[model samples]
Target: GLRNYVQMFTEDPRYWRSVVTTLTYVVIAVPLQLALALVVALALKGMKRGKAFYRSAFYAPSLLGASMSIALVWRAIFNDGGTVDHLSGTGGWVNKPGWALLAVALLTVWQFGAPMVIFLAGLQQIPAELYEAAACDGASKWRQFLSVTVPMLSPVIFFNLVLQTIQAFQVFTPAFAVSAGKGGPADSTLVYTMYLYDRGFVASHMGYASAMAWVLLVVIGAVTAVLFRTSRSWVFYASEGDR
Candidate 1:
């Protein structure tokens, strides 16, 4: 019975579509989020004024993101006549699936402060002498960033990558809240975790939902393994001291 349900849903095109949508979200969101975080962290490093306040302001959204009340607030803000649509002067855009996806993407991007804080901590640990040495050698700032900062930060980057990948794959609240549970006018916001919720709880397809969960685990594992394999080429371990 369980295997049958698992096979049934896994074979369904709609189920696959949800998986693809979620994966696409991760593909587009995670890298851009990390890039933006890294840039902000770099810029904020060594700043003498208002650092604490700035860091707290950036991280505030992360603390609010998963709360039920906060989700409700987001729902109100993205509803058909909510602040966003009103500001854009496009009341109908909320019903458009593409815009729904973009709305979810924006929410995801706005939560970048957590990763940026992590990156800031990582950047601070890097010795200034490394940058000074680069400068002495007439290395451009961009070159110094690539050759020194990136290499030194590889471990931190890898850590953030793995953590964010797992989190992004399981993103549900924003999509559910922003799209108002219909997954939007065309199901554009139907992320995999939301699909699993619908199947397990909504449809009472517990066995099938369990299968989907296992499949998600496998997919995450495979992606992480690929990242680790690729890291050998780029990830610099300080213990090796080989540069």
Candidate 2:
């Protein structure tokens, strides 16, 4: 058992590729996704009309993000001679390693609706009096946002950060479907879970796959622990109650 686990790190180059690819997704997709979501949430919060319709419209993508149909649609859009290439006058991005990964990241980033809703709720919960006081102090809109908006939103930001980071690491369906279940054009889009599926199902390497699953769990757990440990310095709660 232990030997098989060790061999995954030492004997398998594909394993390392999966690790790097998953980290790439986490690093590239999660922050951009959250940032866009926060911006949308802030915009929605400031709107006076058609709020429900706009919220639902913005949220539709997250509802269908994991659906097989969306993946197929994405594949069509990025495939050779597809819409992206047709519009850009460039070659297909799907078959290229770096570009393919970016295409997959784009899919993840597009599904920011859930976090946006969460942020919207969090923004609403912040007392308007805080902003009023900030404005009374002659704070500009940008300064008020940096001081009042962000501090109040810290807890929500931390919540979304942890949840999205975990979700990003587990991203499999987009890569699997976009690559047509092969993680191909040279394993560039082979995320960790995709590789695990290939190992356990396609290659029949159940032992190695199981080892990989456990390692992934450990890695996520360690990262989460670090986040939680550091959160005390940044994540603010109104109920911290004095000092």
Candidate 3:
């Protein structure tokens, strides 16, 4: 009933916290991941040597990052006295609420391989003649990138932005595995999906869980709609002619 849905917000404190955490994760992870991916894509596009090796090496993380095993590996690395602690000469990060989320964000950013590859493909499709013309007009390399590379690749950038935003909101494995399924350390790592799982399965409040799921779906749809609408200003399709 709609009453149950209302209670999800009014009666639930954890639900709101989860919402904040999820949004924070999306805000922090998606842009950083996309930016790093773009840099990597640009680097790969300019490389004349070992491109294949570098591409494979960079992309390997996205292939295995979402797996249970990799999540466990992430947990170990962030846990007390784990690899990061050993390397940084500090105590465990995963046990803390603030740092644990950052650790998870790092893991998310590290899996930028998929978008990087897509960006590389987009870069390859850009016409080289445009760059030559820009150079002839006395444009600097930076100016050329701003004028040519960005506009040409805007479509691809929009694609990755929308896709990664959706993916970021659905992040569950990292929170689940890294927090040991409890969203512990004071539930700071508890994401939207994790809270939904607890409500549906652990707490046996399936109705609330359903409400949360529907809300999430609506949120994603609305965000996507907004992106598509605003994209007319920024996302330049090739058919629209050069801006």
Q: Among these predicted structures, which one has the highest TM-score?
A: 2
- Off by more than 4 A, model 1: 1-6
lDDT of each: 0.84, 0.92, 0.92
**Model 1 Cα shift for residue 63 (angstroms):** 0.6
lDDT of 1 by residue, 1-243 (tens): 666867797688768878878988998889988998898888788688988898888888888877666776766777678887789877744477767676677677778888999999999999999999999999999999999999999999998998899899989998887777767667788899988998899999888789889989998899989988988888898889754
- By TM-score, rank the candidates, best first: 2, 3, 1
Can you tell me which runs of candidate 3 are displaced by over 4 Å?
none
Model 2 / residue 169 / CA error / Å: 0.8
**Any runs in candidate 2 off by more than 4 Å, and if so which?**
241-243
Q: Candidate 2, overall lDDT?
A: 0.92
lDDT digits (tens) for residues 76-129 of candidate 2: 899998999999977788888879988999999999999999999999999999
Q: Provide the TM-score for each candidate, comma-separated.
A: 0.91, 0.97, 0.96
Clashes of each: 0, 0, 0
**Colliding residue pairs in candidate 3:** none
At residue 196, candidate 3 shows an lDDT of 95
- Candidate with the larger lDDT of 1 and 2: 2
lDDT of 3 by residue, 177-235 (tens): 99999887888889999999999999998888888899999999999999999998888
Error in Å for residue 71 of model 2: 0.6
